[model samples]
Target: MLQLKLYYHAKPYLPWRFRMATRRFFAKRKRIRYSGSWPIDPPSGAVPDDWRGWPNGADFAFVLSHDVETQIGYNKLDELLEVEKQLGFRSVINFIPEGEYSVSERRIQELIERGFEVGVHGLYHDGKLYNNRATFESRAKRINRYLKQWGATGFRSPLMHHRLDWLHSLDIAYDSSTFDTDPFEPQPDGLGTIFPLWVERKIANPESLTANQENQISDRRSAISGGKSKKPNGYVELPYTLPQDSTLFLLLRESSNAIWKEKTAWIARQGGMVFLNTHPDYMDFKGNGNASSFPISYYADFLQHVKESYGGQYWHATPDRVASYFVGCGDR
Candidate 1:
């Protein structure tokens, strides 16, 4: 009621007031000056050039990331994995470390053996990482160590929740948490398209921390440093670009494969990365009793459509591979 009242009251003066306010805001802000430090001269050991180019033909890449949590049982994961295998696609599964749905080391190893990438999700799936820098850094380190132990090199933050500025501390080779579209589009500086962008890491000074906090510090600074420090090297960010499976099935109440196929085709023509994200917890047929059945059939059918439509032209790369390619490997 209060919001409605506020909206109604503001409607009268919105046209003039909103325009003037916007103009004043922009007019008062200083223009961002580039220091000629950007573009950083691509690295020597970057991934294969012409990575994005499907010289043979127009190729489509579908890198699936499954956010597996305790709420999603092992049986559901097995079923999802079966569907992926049927589609001939190896997906990257982001596993939580210490949550209800956390996977054991044995299970992680099994995923690795199965040609799937096991990326770090987080210690807990809570949305607390962005609460502050210190907490985020500590949690990142713990997650990184686990990934290292599991022989994984990719990461996707819990809930796709992130503060890109704070990601530099994580030692992972690539991060898959950036998004192209949201409830509204995300506005990141410089990189305008809904494509992968190399997250420029900044070197942190030891002197910046107190004695107690020094040991816990690592160099992952947020990508939004805005010239606060010199950029670090190697790490790349691959953002998820598309409606997540849960979003399609639950939020939009879409249970058809046609919508996904249409969306994928549209994104493919743009010649950019398209990340297909599905959660194991939501793919079950009857475990949760939330929906009528898991959307597994729809997902499998969607993959079949992609394969039939694109043929073998699409690059079947993992999240890490996608990141590496974006850095330089697959340059045109």
Candidate 2:
């Protein structure tokens, strides 16, 4: 309601161009300014040698994901998969089961068969998932059923609207709907760290966190920066780094990979996870297009950059794979 009202009634009156320019300008400055914010504390014993690395000693981690919103984006999945495979990258493509187009179970199966991951986006892009407790609980049941049908354990909210407190009701292993920082989302407060942290069960309990994602605990206070947080992992949260393709390319009018490269460098140094969310509907087929057009190669180029710069220093895992690493049956 607030978001729709803002986009409908207020956007026309607001100087959005000025805002985007200011945001784009500060985006870089913040990136530079907060380079120190991450690796949140000085070298500590809790730091793992491969903080970013994964099983068998990979250095850093990257989980590339695509949110399919329209038929155009949905149509591009095969090509996207080919592009990723050619570059040795496998991504998760989320779909709206009964939204946009009738996304069939067969298509999702095809994605899995192609060695790609499939997850839920939302039933509709209408932004009502969190309207009220009853509405959310009702919709969650359908979402959970679809999740089981797809055999998925990951989710990213439609339009990036999320409520961490309500997530325990979601049966996913982890979520990729958050950002280290993004100014364009409906509730745009960024969580500051690129590292994957457990959404502690107590914290996510409905009584613990308000329905408002913008005013949640992590939003109000820094989740990192102390000695190590003793919070237990209920489910994992892999933070997306770099703004989404739509934000940088179309909104901010960027035309290059400079921001991504800078972010990748910082994340690598800090040994943090990079969970990038791109839309299949928004990217292009060529590798050399401007960011304003979101060339297909923009993502490919970033993958290449990761390969060239960090190489084996990072673990290229799926969302479930990363979460599975943290969740294991103890005392087996």
- The positional error of residue 106 in candidate 1, measured at the CA in angstroms, is 2.4
lDDT of candidate 2 over 107-194, digit per residue (tens): 8788788778888997777677777778788888899899878888788888787787787677666777777776566676666666
lDDT of 2 at 134: 89
Query: What are the models' TM-scores?
Result: 0.71, 0.76
Candidate 1 wrong stretches, greater than 4 Å: 1-58, 184-192, 204-234, 286-289, 328-332
User: How well does candidate 2 match the true structure, expressed as C-alpha RMSD?
Assistant: 8.2
lDDT of 1 at 194: 41
Q: Which pairs in model 2 have colliding backbones?
A: 53-59, 59-313, 60-313, 60-314, 60-315, 73-281, 255-291, 287-297
**Which candidate wins on lDDT?**
2
lDDT of every predicted structure (CA atoms): 0.61, 0.69
Error of 2 at 147 (Å): 0.2
